[model samples]
Target chain A: MSKHLLTIIDYGMGNLHSVAKALEHVAPNFQVEITADKARIAAADHVILPGVGAIRDCMAEIRAQGVDTLVRDVLASGTPFLGICVGMQALMHSSDENGGVAGLNTFPGRVHCFPKDALDVHDLPMKVPHMGWNNVYQQAEHPLWQGIESGERFYFVHSYYVEPQPAYTIGTCHYGPEFAAMVGRDNLFATQFHPEKSHTAGLQLLKNFTDWNGRL
Target chain B: MPLAKRIIPCLDVDRGRVVKGVNFLNIRDAGDPVEVAKRYNEQGADEITMLDITATHEGRGTMIETVRAIAGQVFIPLTVGGGIRTVADIRAMLNAGADKIGINSAAISNPAFVREASERFGAQCIVVAIDAKRVDDHWEIFTHGGRKATGINAVEWAIRMQAYGAGELLLTSMDRDGAKSGFDLALTRAISDAVSIPVIASGGVGTLEHLAEGVNLGHADAVLAASIFHFGEFTIADAKRHMASRNIEMRR
Candidate 1:
């Protein structure tokens, strides 16, 4: 059997090593490589873009490294792709972070910050970043969410959230307000939470992705 | 559903070995840090915190290797604290697969370090660990494993850390630490209410009920305990079950 080639785009942002390690752990038969080489990323059977920190810095690195264009090409070619955290936010049309920044615009959406004074249903002041495990309610069925139940929890850490078109939203989570937790269109899928740190359910999601063939 | 309250099992690593102390003294060995972390992950711990108590420069190298080993095997959020003093140190740990870096003494010694680190590396990964001991009318922040008191008010320090861009606060009560009684509800609530950031209530978690109380009464976003979990007195499942019984949402 031929080993699947999985490439994780490393643009010198936050810790992408953990994401690489988790993918390797879940898909042992696959070759998981972290690289900045566009050729290697473009040639992989499966590609993942995992990022953290500010979107401004991440987008700058993505554009400078020419990954911004390459990622759009990879998506256009119908390769199974996954975007995590800021990687997910970067797929939108634009973001409110760092004044204002344009995203790759692979999907039509805007990223907005959770108001600092946002309150929960219980009237308690909701913490920004939403840093911890929160329930992700499934919005649509997809191969990435196979075996993962609706309303399952995932680890999330970010102040801003992606507001994609309703048609592309696959999962929704509530913090101060309901926001897109997972989005997908055709062969590409993205999540605002870090499945790498979400324990059992998280590993299952990655394992499902490994077995996925870019089909619904 | 709302965000579930986290239950984190803390491992104090000395020279790459896991150790737990009684009353912050009389240290005893538990097991290997990597193995302990994996066990906690399998048992459904929300997260695992490894406190590097290695004092020497040589031992610091061991902590990094230990973090690397655990990150490879355990697929969960791992927080490394105790002696995180520089941006390089934070970067090393994060690069080694740590999800968060907890800074205690450094934040008190130079408050600007918190701002610098937060800006350099986003606030999401900067955790301000405040060790507090009750002094007369209020609690005072301490450093060096609660051996020295900084004479700073705990509530005020929490707000300052938040203002400086700390994503989360790991508030440990020096008075109740290792007492096996319960969390300092008043102290936890005071700091949790003062700051908008999430607070992890650490120190003196003895019973399953204590874990629930940390979130329900103390208003902590998470709870951390060392001895009870290290000594096998209770499991993470037991803590989550007890907390759930009290109506606190727990990630299954």
Candidate 2:
């Protein structure tokens, strides 16, 4: 059997190693490489876009390396693609983080700051950058959530969320009100939560990604 | 959802190799930081804290090369501490691929350094590490690699650190350190109560129960240990299972 190749796109924001480590843990036989090379990215069986930091900086680095073209090409090839945290937000049309910077636009949507007013009313006493565990309500059937129960907890650490069209939204999580927490369309999947940081359930999610045949 | 308690494994790196000791002495060579970090990552460590135990006395900066080396192998939130005295040092560590930079002796020397680092970097990037010893029936902050006493109460100092913009406190009980008995519950609770940011209890965690006690009784957000983990006395998987059975919120 040929080994599966997993390429984790590194754009120099934060903690790219953790994502690669998680993939290796879930799929030990799979080759995990954190690369910025466009050729390697194009040839991978699975691609992971992992990011941390301001949207502007992330987009700038992606553009600088011409990864925007590479990533789009990989998606067009119809291989499994997963974006995590800021990486997920980077798949949108734009983000409000840095005066509306352009994103990969693989999915038609805009990322915006999580509303502070809603948090205040919930008396959750949660600060911005909602840095902890939260329950995710599965809104639709998706392979990524395979073997994972609905309302299962996932680790989250961000203040912005991708507000994609309802057709692409697969799950919603309530910080103040229900917002898109997971999105999927054909071979593309993204989550605002840090599944690598989420623990066993998270590892299982990654396993599902690597083992999935794109049958939802 | 309630905040889940984090299970963190601490690596005390000396000259690139990870080492472990009981009570902070009688150290034993563990393994390569990269190898050990990969082991812990496979076993499901919520986060990893790397401290360059010899960086200060070496008269050099934090171990960037070692950090970068391990960063490629281990894919978990790696928090690097020891010899972080300046913002430039913090930047260098971050660039070397550290998720968070922990400042102990430096933050105590200049309290404003906490605010400065927190302001320049995000608050989440700044972790204030407090090494404390029980002296005169009080937990007093210790410095200079836990060889000198700051004469300040640990709880009082923790509150002050939060005020100065420290996002979290890595509180280590010097008296319990390397003892392998358990954490100082009274001391851990005192610091946890005094600060709003997460408190990571370090020192004297020997068993899975010790980790649970530190979280449930000590009110620690996370528990860090070296000897028990480094010596293979207990794996992180067993620890998490034990904690989960005891009704402690952990990533299982």
Candidate 3:
């Protein structure tokens, strides 16, 4: 078995260790490394960009380490890449969090915070962050979801959800309004949920990413 | 499908060991917390909360190690509580692989710590744990493992905690703790309705029906139990199936 290098893009603002540990648990053959180094991230076989905290701080850290340019460069290579939470949000042009923060503009869209009047299916007013578990409905078939079932529940903890361009939405979920949960375009994939915290289905997604050959 | 109600198995840990007791007394060993947390993870528990019973200054390092061990073994969200008194403490636990941090005594004392931690770490990672006891037609908050009465009204405190930027509340009923009588539905519903954030009803979960009631009647977004799950009365899977049978939104 060939060992794959899975580098988790650590911008000093993401859930670095847990994602690294989760990746190690699921894909044993994949050598996981947490780094902000541009060269190592570029040379890795698979890349996972994970984030937490505010998008403003995350963006500042990413830009400080030039991980944003690295991500754009990696995307251009058609290499297998996955982004989680704010990492996914950073792919957008801008976010409403922290009173309007600019993003990488890798994907043409904007991030909107969940509406205050947003209620769950129960009609009860949902919390701002939309913390805990929620269902992600698959919008289209993708290789990353090979063994995963549609509408599988994944853990989430974010106030703002991405409103990506219609064509790139691969999965969607609801809280106040229906928003994209998982997005994909060729060798790139991202999710609004934390797959590392998402248990079985999450582990499966990580495995699929490791096995993926950056093909459609 | 909507967001399913969570079923969390709380491991009251002390110096890396899991313990079970009534109102924080007469503690008995359950097993290694890491092993227990791993079991719950494999058993389909939505989350695992580790309340460092020895949330003392000296035991902090041991608890951090325990959190690290559990996070390394279990692949689910873990909430570490007990003596988490500062933003530094939250950092240590998060660094140790906890998805969320649980604060009770310290939050009640400083109050601003909740806001500080929430502002620094983001509210989604902060959980305010409230131990309330029904006192004269009202639920009053208790501190120090429910030993000292703080005279803080549970309902009102729940609201303030929310205003202070708590993402979630783990409300436990001191009266029903380890009683197997079921959750304090009145308190759970009152707090769950009082705040927009999710409320996790903990303590006194005995039967599978009680688990269902935590959501259907108590309006809790999650149900946390100890004795029922610790003593091998019912596994997390059994509880989930029971809740599903009761028509509650469950992950399985």
Highest DockQ: which candidate?
Answer: 1
**Ranking of all predicted structures according to TM-score, beginning with the best and ending with the worst:** 1, 3, 2
lDDT of each: 0.89, 0.80, 0.87
Per-residue lDDT tens digits for candidate 3, residues B1-252, read 677889999999887789998877899999998889888888899999999887779899999898898898788888989888877888888888998899988888899999999878878888999999998989999976678998888899999999999989999998998888899999998999889888999989879999899898898999999888888889999998888898888888
lDDT of 1 at A180: 97
DockQ, model 1, C-alpha based: 0.75
With a 3 Å backbone cut-off (N, CA, C), the pairs that clash in candidate 2 are A17-B75, A18-B75, A18-B76, B22-B178, B23-B177, B23-B178
lDDT of each residue in A40-125, candidate 2, tens digit only: 88888899988766677778888988878877787788889888887888889888886788888888889888675552211433
Query: Could you tell me how far off, in angstroms, the CA of residue A133 lies in candidate 2 after the best superposition?
Result: 5.9
Write candidate 3's Cα lDDT for A1-216 as tens digits.
768788998777745888988888988888999987788888899998988878988888888888878998999888799999988999998999889999988788789988887676456787666877888888888998989988889998888899857899989998768888988887898999988888989889988888998888
* Model 1: residues with Cα > 4 Å off, grouped in runs: none
* Model 3 C-alpha lDDT versus the unseen true structure: 0.87
In model 2, which runs have C-alpha deviations exceeding 4 angstroms?
A: A1-12, A20-49, A54-81, A89-137, A146-155, A159-167, A172-180, A186-188, A196-216, B1-3, B31-35, B56-73, B86-97, B110-121, B134-140, B151-167
Give a tens-digit lDDT track for model 1, residues A91-210. 999999999999999889899988877775336788776988999999888888878999999999999998757899999998877899999988899999999988788999999888
Tally clashes: model 1: 0
Note each model's CA RMSD in angstroms.
Answer: 1.5, 5.3, 1.8
Error of 3 at A65 (Å): 3.1
How far residue B64's Cα lies from its native spot in candidate 3, in Å, is 2.0
